[model samples]
Target: MATRTRRAPPKARTTSGPAFEVDAARLPPLGMPPAEFLRDYWQKRPLLVRNAFPGFVSPIQPEDLAGLACEEAALSRLVAHDAAHDRWMLRHGPFPEEMFPEMPDHDWTLLVQDVDKWDADVAALLAHFGFLPRWRIDDVMVSFAAPGGSVGAHVDQYDVFLLQAQGQRRWQIDASEAMGRTAPPLDFRDDVELRLLQRFNPTHDWVLGPGDMLYLPPGVPHHGVAVDACLTFSVGMRAPSAAELLGDFVDTLAADADDALRYRDPGLAPPKSPGEIDADAMERVVEALNLLRMNDPERLGDWFGRFITVYRSGGQVMPGEDARSRIEVEWDLQQGARLHRHPFSRMAWRKAKRGARLYVNGAGHALPARDAARIADNAVLDGPLYASLSEAGRDRVFELMREGHYHLDLRQDDE
Candidate 1:
């Protein structure tokens, strides 16, 4: 059977005005000093902070989110539940615009991940979370649900901040440690498409209004049901499991290993039984595997730098179609042009013995620490910053720009 692509919803006009801002003096984004919150609640307990973004307004409307969901490259999902049968259904997108009108109004949700990468206004919210390491942030996932809509009770393996962007959602949580009790069994219902908890006993419950936020640490069973048509912005952290880390780490070692590096049985005593694997042989296996261990600090850091910058979706950052000379890029920047980081590019930097190395979309560039920091810290580069870069830094920037890690912002005038 031939597969047909669905038509995307019409693009909505971008929100006009100053980007979202947090007035720290009035009400902090975390409802208290960042350090205080980190010390008390971060990964240790759940917190319900009122007016985290006082007088908050959603950056994108439901329609705007629906439009993005229809884009072919979007990581989107539609979840619906049949309350009568206690059954749930899941469907991936790009969904057709016509599907929205056909959906029942109150029993389903539309979730789109990495909304920050898709919309600049949504990305601005990340600036307020400076208390945490920036690289730890996975992405901002936005979900729009009608009244009574929910994905069902579930637990996440990573930290998450559930910020109410519009309307209201009643959140129920079971933080076992904080409640001073044995944790609930981490079991899932086999019948549903979602990984919903088979059993949920929430000790804390609250209804979040616009600007309110809930911070949930890993392993907390929670559920959120929309009170009405609403949007929730989830700022999720990246917490790879031991298995995932080891897999990638070993893969890197295997790629760099020489063919000659192999297990040796110098003191070989033939096995008592040819079919039996002796303890001596097992010890040799352990010794052979130890060769792949990254003991040096620099080697460990280098491996992690490359690993973490890779997007969860494994999206590639392609260079611009037309590569420009360094001189051309410099001239354009001087003429009020701004260079924006590619949405798919994940970037990080590490200080080296000499200076630092910047990693973008799995590739590294050696440069001064200051220059590397500048690139990692600022997603958009402008004239003053460009001119301030050291000769080496400028050259690296030009190279990255040519490679499409950064591109000249065509929307600068509109901004």
Candidate 2:
């Protein structure tokens, strides 16, 4: 059981922020390591880095991002003011040219969402942060904020790192406690769509130039205004609410319900009226949901894992054409085989059972009795780790990765 350590340059400490190097070693380890940062501040504070990505190329150019706004296929927005003085305005695309009529070059901006969806290069750029669990990884959102352009003050439920690739932007962050005390209901007006309740001034205010980055944990209120035109890449983390979990879980249950899954109301009496959903019926629904939660935890994890690993709509992975007949191939977990959950994926209430079994795409296969330990080790690893396995285990792992059930960084290429 040898851990596969990432060999890269160590992160260089800077007076202003975290060291910026292309290699993993140069950057702080992904996610908040418990020992490095205290628990309260780990996912609940703001951190600023003067230089986060050294030698980093702007993943999307400002002009290129603007061009994307013009295309119908792109998700863009325009936010501007229409008043004679002290006006506030905001707009989002796919936008047409008329939306920018005589627009002040400095006060307007075009924000494009999900750039990683279309650009593989940008997506690969993000994969470098896989030091964090793939399950918690969210999508990379890009905003080309122009001077006077702002999304208004707001709080995000998930953690985010704002990486400045070009120009300068002014940012203001407020603690969650302060924001909670005076938070206002979100308003969507025609003039100023997003409103802020608290005012913020950076204690360490300075223009963030290229390669700088800012990290904000969930619930921290923050707002950014472009001091000049700039490109900001947001690496957002995923955090689902209980309501969301229940909704998705219900959907999964409905899809998998057996033919004999009709609700039974054995204690029925002569109804006073035609029909009604009585307390008994409601109780039955609740009971069913409870049953799902109480089911074998291992099976639940397998179900959720499958859902989490599948690609998003229109995001496809092609298996090697020559490997169509390769059912007996081997999978080397030590070679970087790991599960990558989709950003929208939801976690299940179930945890893997105390046995050696591999599940992918809603299907499960039992591991051989002797190799159970190895299989279990791979399944529970929070980060990448390696273990040698028999041919059967390898084949199963390879097949799963090839199907895009998860990602496998093969150590040896089979020619």
**Number of the top lDDT candidate:** 1
Clashes by residue pair, model 1: 319-403
Q: How high is the CA lDDT of each candidate model?
A: 0.83, 0.56
Query: What is the Å distance of residue 292 in model 1 from its true position?
Result: 2.2
Where does candidate 2 stray beyond 4 Å? 1-34, 38-40, 67-74, 82-104, 176-206, 258-294, 310-351, 354-415
The stretch of ten residues in a row with the least summed lDDT in candidate 2 is 341-350
Q: Please give the RMSD to the true structure for each candidate, in Å.
A: 9.3, 9.6
Q: Supply candidate 1's per-residue lDDT for 311.
A: 38
Q: What is the lDDT of residue 406 in candidate 2?
A: 44
Question: What does candidate 2's lDDT look like per residue over 146-220, in tens digits?
Answer: 676777666787888788777777776654342234533433335445554344433233356666677777766
What TM-score would you give candidate 1 relative to the actual structure? 0.90
C-alpha lDDT (0 to 100) for residue 266 of candidate 1: 99
Residues 224-331, model 1: lDDT tens digits: 998888899999998989998999998888998888879999999767799988899899999998877788888788888888888374366776786666777778
